[model samples]
Target: MFWVVAAASAVVLGVAATLAVVFWPKYPALAFQPLADPSRVAPAVPITSRFAAATVRGDRAYFASVSDDGTLGVVAADTGTGERLWGNPAAGDADDWQQLVALPDAVVAVSAEDDDRRRMVLLDPGSGKPLWDRVIGDDDTLLYAEDTVVLVDREEDRLLGLDVRGQGRVRWELKDPGSLSGSRTTTVLAATTPEDLAAPTSAKGAPFAEPLDDDRRIVQIGADRSARVIDARTGAVLVPPRQSVADPDDPVVAHDGTLVVAESDNARRIVAYDLAKLGEPRVLYTAPDDNTRFEHLTPCGTDRVCAVQTTSSDAKTAQVVAVDVAEGGRRWAWPLPDTNNLVPVGDSLLAAQNTTPAKVSLLGADGTVRWTRDGVAARLDGGNLLRFAKPLSTYTDDPSVAGEHLGDDAVELGPLSGVRPATCAWNTAVLACVADEDFVLRRFAG
Candidate 1:
């Protein structure tokens, strides 16, 4: 009788454990903690006086700035120790070092001088030694991905692909020209074919097709709202220029190589073009006409993309919705008030609010808020970590300081008295900031 009772109790406990495991809600593994004291924050090598732009690749931080003497330059520094690695003091006569493309082994600096001459300089990442420099016409645009450098030459009406590490050897050139109509902005999106996506893995764990010379495609969107898709290897026109849209904003490549374009017509809708068949694009999804507008679209996960939708012209009232790019359906939607930006941080999304009493919220993939921190202006670093700041006062004459926080912790870094907004760059291991007259770089404590 005792053995029979024990057996029955064991079976009941097993059933209860199974039910708990099956019904439990799973959440992302992300947490926020208070930052350390500001006085303890370390400093990295001082960059040029006025910082224009900065980006991090690997362990180096590349910055474009104008010196106190009014000269434009590019500087590379060790992100960990604030040590100066290389400096280009005379990048250009004009103070327009617009873009820096950082790769694993090289950094390409793009500069437009006063003569409208565009220059592309490839430098060794470690030594800062110039590998090669090329001068292209002012109308040309440069884009880099993996080991290939793509140049959209508007003057010649051609798209050129060259080996990134080679001596400017042309891999292929395709002629697909369209006018920008004085529009200054153009975007190039690189994608792989469906077969390449499913190719066997190489020894390095990347898809075997990734290293193939001819497996990529380039989609170029001009300022005039015209777009073209070109084969990267043979310069073949996969999709011609006639597939232009009337109102095109953000063009993102889906995982399956579909070019997704958000078009705002009488009604806002998402149109997708299969790169394999650049014919008539199919409407992926459409927004119901209720003052609805789609602002931006970004990758959410493997199968879906997130779109920031605003009900009115006021950006302060916005909601993020995840849409299935392949199946054409809404997955989830989350409301965010006063949203300044929506950045994907790790497996979560960080919604930064721009209004008074600024707040940052971490959102899960399932549209749940994991945590929220107030009284801070936050931005995502290159590594997707959060860097926060709080202004001391609005009065410029006041000597009040802006408090800086590395994470969600309460510990403040040494305050920057009199600096209203401090520009910063951070990775998982280090935080570099320019506050008032100081450029400080501090390491993260384990």
Candidate 2:
């Protein structure tokens, strides 16, 4: 009897331990945190009308100001203290629009003029003081990724890479038209210091995260119409991602420090190259015959790339397949004939299908549809999805279904019951919005 009782107790204990381990809840990386109740907070600048542009970087909020007197300028406010850091109502274009981008080191003001002469101005991030100004043709653009700005000077016929951490110093400038295309990493040719690993991995302003990558390179089309990936930090030409020439018209895409592309034109194989392991490009997918084709490629979830393929001319043959980035292997696949678009937000993906009022589906990391809704307009801001009762307009006037999307759960923000966040800038921790023609700031986290 003693042996029988002892064996029974051991069996019961083992079953209990196995049950506990099996039923435990699973959570993902960078899990969503709940937002506090909404409260009326003061904005950094006086709001007389809608702001032309608004951006948040690091700790400061920058907005284009419009006064009753028709004066136009840029305003900077501290998101933490709710105090006005600085304001300049007479800088850049006085009568036109000023596009503001608050970089960690400097604030940029772009003149959205009505003509081809576009003006670019840099300002001190803290003091809101003007640093320098330049005029470039409308075709020229200033592109910054990972704290480095590339000035594609068409008029000067050169590609100049400037460090955003310093006084816009030129780290490398290549006047050769052939080396002007493709994207690259850091090197010594540009004579830049050993790569700074401490640089913030993503561009600050737009909440559409850029895959948190250090692919500090520019994708340019050269005079020979060939793709050449140039090291934006050093003026050196890095190895071409593929031996076969990529189509000049087709753009090269970078996701999570990996480059994904199909060869130039009418290619069947889809290849992905890890930037660090440039010598080896992984073949993710290969079509068996000409009937199969790549419909599109989209960044999915946190570390997967979704490739939509069609096996035949029949629309029913289309399907969505997920590819694991680091592992370089196919993970999941499901048929979806009307795959309109898929954009990754935080760890989830916001998907839209082709319809009159596009159907919205929130996909999980493993390509599962966490939630789906119809006839509703969804806005992807910060790490949350702002669900409006109706499609959002220029300025929202309705209460929204607001919170961070945590897989199958939400942020549980109850007090956002009567707030409109359509015209706001959010970056995980805080949100600054235009309310009642008044500027207000709201905190998302403790």
The Cα local distance difference test for each model comes to: 0.56, 0.55
lDDT of 1 by residue, 1-446 (tens): 99999999999999999987887433211233333333222122333444444455556766555555544555677866677677765444344555555666567777655476777877777776667777887777775555767887766666788776786778887654444354445566666443333222211112212233335667776666667777665567787774465333463554456777777666577777776666787777788775777765655555566677887757766887777777887878888866655654333556666677666676777878766776443323211243344433322222211222222433333443332233434444444444443334445433
Give candidate 1's TM-score: 0.67
- For residues 319-393, what per-residue lDDT tens digits would candidate 2 score against the true structure? 677777666667877776666555555455566656556566666667777776652323233244544334433
How many backbone clashes does every candidate have?
14, 7
Worst 10 residues of 1 by lDDT: 200-209
Clashing pairs in 2: 181-220, 181-228, 182-220, 182-228, 183-229, 190-235, 247-264
* Displacement of the residue 78 alpha carbon in candidate 2, Å: 2.5
lDDT of 1: 0.56
